[model samples]
Target: MTKPNILHESPSQTAGPYVHIGCAPNFVGIQMYGGKDLASNMLDPETSGERITLTGTITDGDGKLVLDGLVEIWQADANGVYPSAADTSGTADPHFTGFGRCPTNLDTGIYQFQTIKPGQTKMRDGRAQAPHITMWIVARGINIGLQTRVYFPDESANATDPLLQSVPEDRRHTLIAHKLDDQTYQFNIVLQGDEETVFLDI
Candidate 1:
């Protein structure tokens, strides 16, 4: 009997130019979904927490701005509760979605998010994690979305965070955001090079 030829799996492809058209139509002026983009607003008036603004630029291996990148963030609420069915710690803020998404500005290549500073959340093993936001990024040339964490500077809890501790001491700095003011933070993401931000596999 002749041996059968095996088909190899198809290689992953980049996000492509149409990413914004489908993921954030309002951004590209497509005016879909009632003219509003999902995750554009993470909170309402009744949301509880210290409102904060996260702004940054995404740069490539050559230090060039990634003008078409899209960023998404997921985090727990102010009281360390997540708005998910799997979370049994406590009820999360009903007015806060705990998730957000934004595309880099075409003109300036900057992305920003207005949300609350999350509180420390417990890990599956019951250890407390530092207050941080889980960030995911995708762009024209990215075959797969990049995942990372945005840890706040000067948080004492960071010293004991299990995930943070797992990262190399020197590279751990890449995970921290710079505080610009009381409510503003800057967290630049470098796709590659000497200052490349550390990305998580998951």
Candidate 2:
């Protein structure tokens, strides 16, 4: 019998050391893209809403910081509308991109983004979701990027959010970003061990 022309799938690889070079060239002082990294700033003066800053560190299973990690966030505008073509509401803030990216500071091992606090959004099933930001993280040893959400603490809607409620009571705190101030929040991500953040498969 003739052997089938089988094409094997390539094995997955981790985001190597060069991830910063390709994803955020300016981070390594390459001076590309007008000397700024993509999604480095998610806001402009005209972007509507209360401006806020998010800061976090990514820690590995051994409690060591992942200094070279990259974090990206996607969130709806303050009016609960997404600035995407897929958002048919036609009410999304034109000045808000609803996305941001930052590479971890080599020395501090922290990533930060300046953005507006997202408003409550609805789930596919028409359930109201609490204000949250979707986060994607990648680093040297992470074979596949990890995905999670940063839900603001003290939001009344959190009690009814479908996704937040789906998480176990003990693990739900892993998804919340603690308020550091009126305009800042901190959300450290633990990649393993007892306090591992609740990652979503999606």
Winner by lDDT: 1
Question: Which RMSD does model 2 reach against the true structure?
Answer: 3.8
> Candidate 1 lDDT, tens digit per residue, 1-202?
3357966657667888678998999999898999899999998988999999999999999989999999999999999999999999999899999999999999899999999999999988999999999999999989988999999999999999999999998899999999999999999999999899999986
Model 2, residue 51: displacement in angstroms?
Answer: 0.7
Deviation of model 2 at 68, angstroms: 0.8
What TM-score would candidate 2 get against the native? 0.93
Please report, in order, the local distance difference test score of every candidate based on alpha carbons: 0.94, 0.92
Q: What is candidate 1's CA lDDT for residue 55?
A: 94
List where candidate 2 sits over 4 angstroms from the true fold. 1-12
lDDT of 2 by residue, 1-202 (tens): 4458976657668888678999999998898989988899889899999999999999999999999999999999999999998877558998999999999998899999999999888878788999999999999989988999999988999999999999999999999999999999999999999999999996
**In candidate 1, residue 128 scores what lDDT?**
94
Runs off by more than 4 Å, candidate 1: 1-12
State every prediction's TM-score relative to the real structure.
Answer: 0.93, 0.93
TM-score of decoy 1: 0.93
Worst 10 residues of 2 by lDDT: 1-10
lDDT of 1 at 190: 97
